[model samples]
Target: MVLDDLGSSLRGTLKKIANAVHVDSKLIKEVVRDIQRALLQADVNVKLVLDLSKKIEKRALQEKPPAGMSNREHVIHIVYDELVNILGGSRELPIKKQIIMMTGLYGQGKTTSCGKIATYFKKKGLRPALIAGDVHRPAAYEQLKQIAEQVKVPFYGDNKEKNAVKVVKDGLNKFKRSSDVIIVDTSGRHKLEDDLIQEMKDIFKATKPDEKLLVIDAAVGQQAGSQAKAFNDTVNITGIVLTKMDGTAKGGGALSAAAEVGAPIVFIGTGEHAGDFEKFDPARFISRLLGMGDIKSLLEKAEESMKGKDAEKTARRLMSGKFTLHDMYDQMDMLSGMGPLSKVAEMLPGGFSGKIKDIDMDDTQNKLQRFRVIMNSMTDEEMNDPSIIRASRVKRIAHGAGVENRNVKELLKYYNMTKRMMKGLSGNRKMRKNLMKQLQFGK
Candidate 1:
C-alpha cells in the first residue's frame, strides 16, 4: 500500500495526455510539470523527480510513434517504463544458506520483520532460525522466542548474556548446521550515535552476514532515507523491509528513500502476524500506486493467505454473480487471511481507499463474528436464499444469534445492498470494460 498517492496523482496527469491526440510542446511541458509536482509532494527527491521528468519530456517529443501505436500510447508506455526504472526494476533478495542481519532504529518493527522473513523462507522449503542479538531491549529476546514458537522455527538468544556480538557469533555456529537461513535481530537506538554504530559494526564483523537488511517504519516518511543512510554508513544494506505499510499513508516516503539509496525493497509487512508478509512485486506495486486494481496480485495474496478450493470456489461465485451472504461470510474469512481491510482496499481501483477513510475498517473482525452468529441462526433455506426472511423470521433469528432484531435487520439490509450492487455491476458491460482498461493502463 506504499506509494498509494502516486497512482491517483499520476493518473490525473496522464489523463490530460490521453485526452489529446497530438503531442505538442505545451502539452509535454504541462505533463512534466504535473509529474514533478506529484512526485515532490509525495516526498520524492527533487533531483530525481526533475531528472525523470526531463527524460519523459524529451522522449515524448523526440520518439517516433511505432506502427499501429497511437501517439498517446507511445507516450504512456515511455512514462511507465521511465517510472519503473526510477522505482528500480524488479529485484529479489539473494536467497542462500547464509546469515542475514536485520538492523534499524528502535520501534521500526525489526523484531517482527525477522520472524516474518524467517516464515517466508520456511514456506520456500528452507529451515530458518532466529537469532535475537537485541540485548538492549528488555523483552526483545522473549518476543523473538514467542515469534519463533508461532512460526515453528528455531531461536537462539540469552537474556543473561550482555555481549550482543558474542551472542550473534554463538547463534550462528549453533544454528548453522540445522538452519538454512540464520536471521540475527540486532539492537537499535532511539537516534544514531557512536556507540550504536560501533556495536552494529562489531556484530557485522562477528557474523559476517551474507545479507544485511534494514527494517524501516513506513510511517517515518522522509526520514527513512536518512535512516537508511545512517545504518548503511556502519553496515552494508543489501535490501530493505518496509514495515507497517498496511497502516501508513506515508509509506510512499519509504519508497522514495529506497529509490534514493538504490536499495530494492524485498519485503513488506502488511500486519502483525508472521504470515502477513509478502514479496515485493514491481508491476503489481505500480498498479496499486496508480489506483488501478492489481487483481492478479490480490488473487495471489488471497490464495497465499487462504487454502484449499474454497478461494477458487468463491472466485467462481463472485464472477458468476451467485454471491450470497454465506459467500460473503466465507469471503470475510478469506479476507482475514489476506491481512487488514485497509490494505485490501488500497489495491482497489479509482482510489476506493478514500471511501472507507472515515470508517473503522478494523472492526472487520468483530463485524464478521456478529454476522456469522446471525447467519448461523438462519434457516438452511434462508442462508441459501435470504429473500424469504420476513419480519417474524428476522426477530426469531435475532434471538437465536444473541443479538438485537435490529442487528439482524441491518445484516439483511447489508446483504441486500451487496446483492444489488453486484447485480448492477454484473449487468453493466461498459463498467466492466472500463475497469479492465483502467487496470491495464492505469487510466
Candidate 2:
C-alpha cells in the first residue's frame, strides 16, 4: 500500500484504457494527460513527468501490438515499463560477507534502516552485526543498540567515545571474526554539515564498506536528489534507501529524484516494523501500483511466514477441505506473520487491491484475533468438530473468551462459510489447480 494515492490514480487511468473501444491517438493523449496529472499530484518532477508522458504516448501510438495482444494490453505494457524506468530499474543489495555503511541527514530513519537492513540480510541466512557509529548523538547509540537487541543481532558501540571512526574500526575488528555482514550506522546532521561529511569520509576510509547507502525520507520530495548527490559526493553512496514511503504522497518525487541522481533504490521501508522493509523491485512495484498484482512477492511473503513443509501441509488440507479449528488457528498465525492484510491484498491479482480499499482492515484483524481467542477457549473435541457445539457450549465459549454470545455464533458462521467455500473449490479440479498455482504451493 505504499503511495496508495498514486496507485489509485494510476489504476483509475489504466481502467479507462481497459474500457476504451479502441487505442487511437485521441485516447492515447487522454491517458497520457491522466498519468501526468497523477504524477504531478504525487510531487514528481515536472520535466520527468513530461518526458515519461511523451514516451508512453509515443509507444502507445507507434508501437504495434504484438501478435495475439490487443491494443489495450500494449498500452498498459508501455505504461508499466516506463513507470518502472522512472522508479529506477530493479536493484538488490547483495547478501554476502560484506560491510555496509549507512548515511543520511538526521531524522531520515538512517539508524533504524541499519537495523532493518541487518534483519533483511539475517533473514537471508547471513550472520550480521550492527555497529553504532553515531557518536554525536548519545540517543542514536542507545537506539541502535536497542534495535540490535530487538533483532537479536550482534551490536558494537562506545557511548563514551566521541570518535566515530575509532568506533567503526574497533567494531569491525570485534565482529568481523564472527559475522558475515557488518552494518555501520553512521551519524547525521540536520543538514549537510561539514563535520558530518568529514565523519562519513573517515568512516568510509576505516571500514572500506562494500556498500554505502544513503537513506532519505520520502516526504523530502524532490529535495532528495540534492541530498543524495551531497552524500554521494562525500562517501560515494552505492545505493539509496527511501524510508516512510507508505506515509508520504511525495514518494513519487523521492523515487524519481533518487533515480535521476543515478542512485538505485536498493530497499524501501514500507512500514515501521522491521519486517515491513523489502527489496526494491521496480517491475513488481509498478505491477502492484497499476493494480496488476505481484504474485511473486505474495509467494515470497508466504514462504517467509511459514516453513515449506508446513505451508504444503496446510495447503493440501485446505484444498482437500479437511481442516479443523486448530488448522484455522494455524492459518491465522501464518497470515499475521505475513504483515498487514491490506499489504497482502495488494499482491492479489485482478484489481483486487482496489476493491480491498473499501474494507476496514484493522477491524478485520481485530475480528481474526477475537476468533483466535474464542477458539482458544474451546476444547479439542469442540474445535475438531463444531457440530457438537450447542447453545450451552457457545455460551461457555463466549463467557470464557470475554465476549458476547453473538461473537461466538459469528465465528461459527464464518467457519461454516469457509468450509463450504473450500468444499466447492475441492469439487472443481481446474479452479483448485489454478488457485494452487497462484499460491505456488509445493513449487
Candidate 3:
C-alpha cells in the first residue's frame, strides 16, 4: 500500500463518478480537486500535483471517448495515463552482464537493496554476486554477507580492509569470471559530505558500473527529489530504487524522486522480506494504487509462492468440504511465506481490494498467528474433525495454546467462516470450472 492515503482517497473520489449519470464538467472538476487533495496529502510536490491535475482536467474535458467507451471511462483513462507519465515509464535494468553500484544516503536500505537486486537478477537465470565495498559502515560487510546467504548468491568482501577502493577492486577481480552481474554496495553518509561523495566517485571510476542506483527511503517525501539530484550529480546515477514503500504515506515523493533527475525507478521494495521486492512498472503500479489491480504481478507471485506446493490437492480438498484446520494452517503458512498480506491484498481486483480496506490487517494478521499457535496445540484427530470438539475440548485447547478460551473461540469462528465461504463458492459449478481453468493445476 505505497501512498495508502492516495489509494483510499483517490478510489473514493473516482467512485463518486459511479453515482453520476453523466461525466460532465462539474464532475470532472470535482474529481480533479479530489485527486489534487489526495496527491498533496500523500506529500507529492505541490507544483507537480497542480500540473498533473491540470493535465487530467484538460484531457477529461477535451478528449472524446474512444469507440465503445463511455464518458466516465474516458475520464478514468485520462487520469490513469497522466498519472503513469508523471510517475515514470517503461524502464528496465539491463539484461546483459552488468556491474551495479549502489549509492545513497545513510540508512536508506542500500545494503538490503543490493541483496534484493542480486536476487532479482539471479532469479532471471543470471549468476549474480554481491561486493561489499562499504568499508565505512560498521559491520556493513557482515550484513550484506548474511543477505547474500539468505538470497543464496555468492558474496565477496574484505572485512579487515580499511580502503573501500581496495575492497571493490578485489571483489571485482574475484567475481568477474564467475558472475554475470556483480552488485557493489558502497559507503553512505548521514548527510551529503565531501568525503562520502569522493568515495562514491572513486567507486564509480573503479567499478565502472552499468547502473549506479540511488536507493531512497520512501519516507523522505518530496525531499527525495533534492536527494536524487545530488546523487546523480555526484556519480551520474542511472536509476533509482525506492525502498520501504509499504505503509508509507510519503511514498508519493519517493515515486517521483526520479523525476528530478530524469532517471526511472528501476525497482521498489514493498516489504522487508527478500521475496517482497518487485520490478517497478509505472502502468501496473498506477493501476494497483488506483485499485484497478495488477494481474501480471499477481500471477507471477502466485507461481513463485505456490511452487512445489500441493495447490491441486488443496483445491480439491477445499471443494470437497475437507479443508480441515490442519489444511488451514498449511494455507496460512503458504500465504505468509509469499509476502506481506497487504501486498497480496492489492493484487486482488478493485471490487475485492476496496472491501479489504475495512479490515484491520494488523489485527487479522495477529489473529492468523494466534490461529497457528492454537492449531499447533491441537491433536491430529481434533484438527481433522473440528466438529467433534466440545466445550471441554475447547478449554483444553485454549489452555494448551496458552491463550484465553475466547481466543480459541475466535479461531473456530474464523475457521467456520472460511469453511462456509469455500463451500458457498464451491457450490457454484461454473465458478469451480472457471477457477480450475485459470489455475490449470494439472496443465
Candidate with the larger TM-score of 2 and 3: 2
**Clashing residue pairs for model 3:** none
* CA lDDT of every candidate: 0.75, 0.82, 0.78
**RMSD to native, candidate 3:** 24.2
Ranking by lDDT: 2, 3, 1
Cα-based lDDT at residue 354, candidate 2: 56
Give me the runs in candidate 1 sitting further than 4 Å from their true place.
Answer: 19-23, 281-284, 291-443
lDDT of 2 by residue, 70-146 (tens): 56677888999999989876678876899998999988998889889999999899999999999998898899999
- Note the clash tally of each candidate: 2, 0, 0
11: Cα error in model 2, Å:
0.6
Measured against the true structure, the TM-scores of the candidates, in listed sequence, are: 0.61, 0.66, 0.65
Better of 1 and 2 by lDDT: 2
The TM-score obtained by model 2 is 0.66
**If both were scored by lDDT, which would come out higher, candidate 2 or candidate 3?**
2
Q: What lDDT does model 1 reach? A: 0.75
Please identify model 3 stretches exceeding 4 Å from their true place.
293-443
Instruction: Encode model 3's per-residue lDDT on 1-443: one tens digit a residue.
Output: 66677888877776665434556899999999999988888888888899999999998988766644545556777888988988866678977798999999988989999988888898889999999998876689899999999999999988889899999999999988999999999888898899998898887888888888999988887778889888877778888899888858889876875665677888989888787788989998888888755333333454454454445555556656668888787567444443223443454446645655545565676678888889888999999888888899999999999999988887786667556545754677775665555556543
Candidate 3's C-alpha lDDT?
A: 0.78
